[model samples]
Target: MGPGNRPLDLEWLEDFLALAESGNFSRAAQARNIAQPAFSRHIRALEEWVGVDLFDRSAHPAALTAAGRRFQPLLEETLAQLESARIKARAAHDQAAASLLFAATHVLSLTFFPQWLGGLESQLRLGPIQTISDSFHACEDLALQRRVQFVLCHGHPEVPGRLDEAEFPMLRLSDDVLLPVSAPLAGGGGAMHSLDAAEAAVPVLAYSEPSGLGRIMRARMRQVFGEGSSVPTLPQGVDIVFTAHHAALLKAMALEGRGVAWLPRSLIAAELKSGALVAAASAEWNVPVEIRLYRQRADMAPAAEALWTLVQERPPGSGGR
Candidate 1:
């Protein structure tokens, strides 16, 4: 016994099963790519470890002893389970190695992230990406808490928020504009109910207070229309009738002719093209916004750093739709 036999190696167990299946020491050794003497030694080691003879050598094609027959199934199952564990462990390790996590606002996650990521994949060696799609506030929290490597959201130059671009480095990724749009009038032909309609009738579909686009729009509205005449208050004096956090939900309501909504051009481009939605306000009311990515100043995982570098190299609007 090697070193007075602390324990038998897993190879000895495998050798024992191979011999049981092949029914010949020489054949088992050949199948295992080892010499007969080594194979016999492995079998002897396993038998010694188990404290019993495992095979009847007197048989022409060696047959299993009663103990070996019982041990055969047990060893086969143990090896299978260990192999499975090995695969899962390697998979987990690879995921940890390549993972780059991101947090994004709901609208961008749906409309922009996929296309933007696809373009990067065409040029870079991106591994795995995990994106958490949430409300703007939630996404900001994830970034500030260091739970995610990057935060992707819509940004306006003048608007201020929790994540100061000064503290967290930012990369402008693309350009988009906010359009105040409404559903086409019931009879159609590309006409829409006006945002400047009767005070009582001008139902306003609005983003909730915590929305990122809403934050931008609020600031821009005050600058464009003056404090008293912003989006919440029409020139004729009507407040928002419906409010929600998601742009998609607001779009749905607007499509049903419920009210006017300030939506992203990227989000409602199809509707605008098809005459399903029309501008609710004039050019002065439109807000120019940038698609921005922000990352902590601290160094992140190598995969995340590589992704950040790739994004920084691309010109704004490089692969945008």
Candidate 2:
């Protein structure tokens, strides 16, 4: 077959390059660790494929013919390009293997993920990470669809979410409290709103339906008050003046004295500490919850698996890193 139609072997190209470099068939064969006859046949086959005599056999040391000379630079460049392509392919594969993907509820992503990841970094060498922060429902969809390796969010055992129903493996990373909080009263005396207020309806900054926290809060409120009670089931009636999918947003409104919001202790710790916010209700009104991480049951990339292993190894109540 002519060069255009021939099935060219890559080894032949390598052998040809070796021979051109050494200019001696015997030495090139030795360098290639191939039998001399086999090496000569490879060169002959390559030359035939190219439709030209690539080497002047009569030279003191075999020399490239005019066509071989032209072929040499092109072959060298082609080989270099192939090697580059090979390296880049391997690098891309390694990066993908080492990378970790996560979906987190917006509040935890902002308030918890950074410190937790930093703690893990102290123990393991992690690769690239991409975290998608969205509403709880969105994060659950990502996890259920296997679009992310892990999902981080709040959970209450009594109020199991879709991930729980799906039987996705989970780790309770830490304990958190969902408690009523509000901006400090004028002159920083006390909370601006109270769960025990006897007179007026308490203005509440509430979570939207899409929020995982909203689900847990609603269920827990029903259990605490009574199944017969309606929404905003606190002992004292409430008026939900604002609703949002993120605790951070509710917190911002609370700071402005807008209303009381049941926010995660982790998210409002700074506010509570600095007196920018205060408990709107007593400890009896607090709802206990878990900071949970869930993963698909299917096999994951090595880095993700390793993270799961580390999380499993941590002692119960040890804040997950």
Candidate 3:
């Protein structure tokens, strides 16, 4: 806490505690995924509010001042209890509170999300649900604002700290495919004969840019095509590929044979199994991604927990830790 300029914001108290525990602003920012400068400001605001020097500036790794030490456990327990109460309140109003918002990469939205909900309903025995899609951080914002009870997204390098990392015991659905697929049954048939023929004939459908799947495909394509090569085939028949967009649109495009489309095997499983679509190459072209559910350690509602538990119990072939 600083020497008194602002009233204490309990939220800052939490940030102060996280900073104290981590002891490095950069790491703390990464853990928080906010800019370090912004996090520092929050810490400063906290100190200003509390009217005390919370940490020893001269010390390395940010040791807390006597005042901070004295205050830690009290704040932690108090916040925990307050959060517990919030969860109960949410459960009591779950049906009306039943408004849920989560995000997913296109693949999850297309494939597993639907499957998971069906399973979630069967498990929780719920009827009618609401959901939305956006990038991972959007879910983080919504949850922080209490706009959503939960979030689901692909696990990535910075994921653990970006969202609250609780054990969301998952049931893995069948590993899905995201190989190039085509809408025109005839267009797809020729590519099935040989891998070389497939690569040679069509521009591999790829996510447009700056996306996880797109990044993976770009690196892999370079490795396969050779170093310093530009996107091996141009106009590679992109049916407007975007892994971040809605899955249903991608699926519709592939089903229409707009071009060779990379999409989830799980979403197109029935199509592929029925021979309506063919993998552009073998399954080797696609990467397996996760669809984990998350709730903050302090903010899960009972109905939310109930939904999570249902998600946890389903066949977890695809949704593992």
Judge candidate 1 against the unseen true structure and give its global Cα lDDT, from 0 to 1.
0.83
Q: For model 1, how does the per-residue alpha-carbon lDDT over 1-321 read when each residue is reduced to its tens digit?
A: 342555869999888878888898988999999999989988887778888888999997999999999988988899999999999999767657647888999999999999998998898877877889999999998888887889999998788678875478999999999888888877775436565554455667778887999888767776332364444445464457898989999999999988788899999999998888998867766778999999987998887888888888888999755
TM-scores across all candidates?
Answer: 0.67, 0.68, 0.50
Per-candidate clashes, comma-separated: 0, 0, 16
Candidate 1: list runs displaced more than 4 Å. Answer: 1-98, 189-191, 197-201, 223-233
lDDT tens readout by residue for model 3, 140-183 = 56666666666665543322424544343333344443466665
Order the numbered candidates by lDDT, best leading: 2, 1, 3
Worst 10 residues of 1 by lDDT: 223-232
| Top TM-score hit | 2
Ranking by TM-score: 2, 1, 3
Q: Rate the local accuracy (lDDT) of all candidates.
A: 0.83, 0.87, 0.59
